[model samples]
Target: MTARLNPDLLHRPGLAAYRLSRALALSRIGSWHSYAVIATPRAGMPAMPKGYSYRIAAHMGEFEAVAGVAGVDLAVAQRRLDDGCVCLIASRGAAPVGVTWISLKPVREDEIAALYDCGGRAAWDLGLHIAPEHRASRAFAALWAATGDWLDMHGLAWSLSRIALYNAASLRAHARLDAQLVGRVQALQIGRLQWLRATIGGQTTLHLSGIARPPKLALAAAIMV
Candidate 1:
């Protein structure tokens, strides 16, 4: 997976020093832990608002519309949709208000490998986003509930997702849906070398990758999203 850095950080001075410091810290210690939450049939879905509705996009046109409303790249979303990724779009009347992506196969962007090892019965939910104006409402929760329902209808027994440790809002949202924390993942990096470790309950696995780069080059290759 390609590392995506926040553009706002690029203009700041001492970026090299900052990147080096972060890399060193991560290598010696580790990046913040990301929690893996699971959704099952027993954890019932949430009720959407009176005027809101959710459905899987039926075509690229619908996907493009939703992507436009969500401020995401139309081409990227179309590619994912073409590759069999599912896009759930939530709308009020005829206007899209929220969108989420789900995958039955492995998604490299999520950077988690264990979920895919569970055979094709597992689903991964990612890229959940709600319009700012609808944030205070139950849109997100409703979308999640709909996703769970979709998973069940498809005969999938498990739904998995990773949330950053510092994302309290997301954690609370997942908690409200009765999602169980089944695992955690952390990353470490030094120069071009990077390591990713996952702990599912008591089991742990580590993966390492990267190219050789000058120690002082300060490549920001292991940033947390």
Candidate 2:
């Protein structure tokens, strides 16, 4: 999780290519891009910012109940349920208003499994979001505060997550929590051909390589559900 960017390359001529790549990936003959975030679990369960109720999904039924309010697809929710991933939910009164998932197993998304490592002391944090209507409140912070408590209880050392480069809001949300950028991944496609460039431990630079097929889901459809 301590992976650092290659400063020399990034500060030189690489910055332009990095920023310009987003435009080239706007179509089918486009690209896939994401960066990974790593954060250590902080102690204490701070009060849910606005008195919103916070709790963990103990079973599939709870996960399903929160799916709609959480704005997560039922199918996607079920897969996470089966994988033993836990969802932290915050409700405004009787309505579920925010959700976040914690996974101790491997990253289910194939595009990134080959790049970031997960398991043991490190856990993968999937979607973390507050409903559109509840965005103006402190529900996002409350949910994260709840997550820190949960992670500390489980003895986890690090929380890892991936966000699409284009998703500025999600990036800022995580950055506000003091997350460190530890991995870089991008896939450039032209018609039927796609190439991949991702973080490989021990390497300090991004290198593009050919791939037979691209992943069906590059990362989260929306940085958060």
Candidate 3:
């Protein structure tokens, strides 16, 4: 007889609720937590393949390289996620083969309200990631598919996903899932010139011509709409 493996066996139920609560508390304190679940294809592949499993991130530098490749500053991202948790999917006994980060926020009506006019709806925002070492494996795709399932189970069918304009791999993956590009975002930075200054009527005026906001880093949104 062929044995059927139940995926539910690997789930940490109450933990999700606890994390969400913690996130809420942090948000109240002006901090946020990124919450994401590891995406696995199926349980028949064997719970974690002896060394493969999922866990939460304990360090900031671990994501530095990946974030750099994507042209995103981790310092800025941390504040955006409100100091959220980063959940990782690992291979070979849980050694962090890849990662998925999630931020729970309200779907802005100004952004997705138009969807209602087009016979669609709004959902949650998700940030996904995978390590370089595990890029060749089925980890990324599996994680994506699993993420959708998790969203559905959580009663979030109208979820939204965002990908950096420079990340071709992510774009391709989302394309494979039939995610449509909706909009673009630009990133800009601004810095003050401390050394140069002009005295005008006893008021110091700094000459800052190149001191402009950083370029807008484009972000494309995709949804089932």
Candidate 4:
């Protein structure tokens, strides 16, 4: 019998494309091993242990849960989920404790040069999130650390994660990981006078990116999620 793929899996672009490439590469060299490990020897609070694992965020059930909370419509969420992004979950004895989604991609050549022009080389953007209940847990730290592990293991030398300026928790978490606040970006949106007048008079949110510092914490950073 053929190994059937999950219908939800079919919706992810990064997986749909990368899976084929990864499969061919695996046939010749290595196979994905992380999920099996993730499913094994579950921890009480932190589901993921210190080790390697394959990562992706295209699973439908997980996707829907997050989307529902974030108020993202089903179709849009599915489209992005199909893209080159990933979602991670922390489970305890068959109970889901937490989840996070992330994307793995290289900094654009222009962005790379921009970083170098500013005295940097490589970077990746992290826009995924973890559930609120799991905050401050070992699982949260493990996942953050695993993100770096995935980048290094996959040869994406340098990586970056964006965090909001107002999110003290994330700021502190990344700081623990040794992430640095590189720069900030502004997002603009047109809205009702009521909301705009109360906030920034029609302005949007400003974000910051924190980059990894090699085998340590995230060096450079970007502001998105």
> Which candidate wins on TM-score?
2
Q: Write the per-residue lDDT of candidate 3 for residues 57-103, one digit (tens) a residue.
A: 43565555445322235764464345343433343343445555543
CA lDDT of each candidate?
0.57, 0.60, 0.36, 0.36
Tens digits of lDDT, candidate 2, 1-225:
343323332343334544666566554356554454334335323545666777899578878777766667777777777767889998777777889888776555534323334635466777786788888877877787778767777776457676665555565556666565665566555555555566533234444434543332222211121
Q: In each prediction, how many residue pairs overlap at the backbone (N, C-alpha, C within less than 3 A)?
A: 0, 1, 20, 22
Residue 169 displacement (Å), model 4: 1.7
Q: Candidate 4's residue-wise lDDT over 117-180, tens digit each?
A: 1113333444344446645545565555455555555544434443433344444444444343
Q: Which 10 residues in a row give candidate 1 its minimum summed lDDT?
A: 214-223
Residue pairs with clashing backbones, model 1: none
Q: Say which candidate scores most in lDDT.
A: 2
1 or 3, greater by lDDT: 1
Per-residue lDDT over 1-225 for candidate 1, one digit per residue giving the tens place of the 0 to 100 score: 121122232224224434644675657753323343334332445656688788888468777656655656777676567656788888878777888887765554433222233335467677888888888877776677678767777776556666665455665566665555555455555455666666654456666766232111111111111
- Report the lDDT of model 1 for residue 5: 20
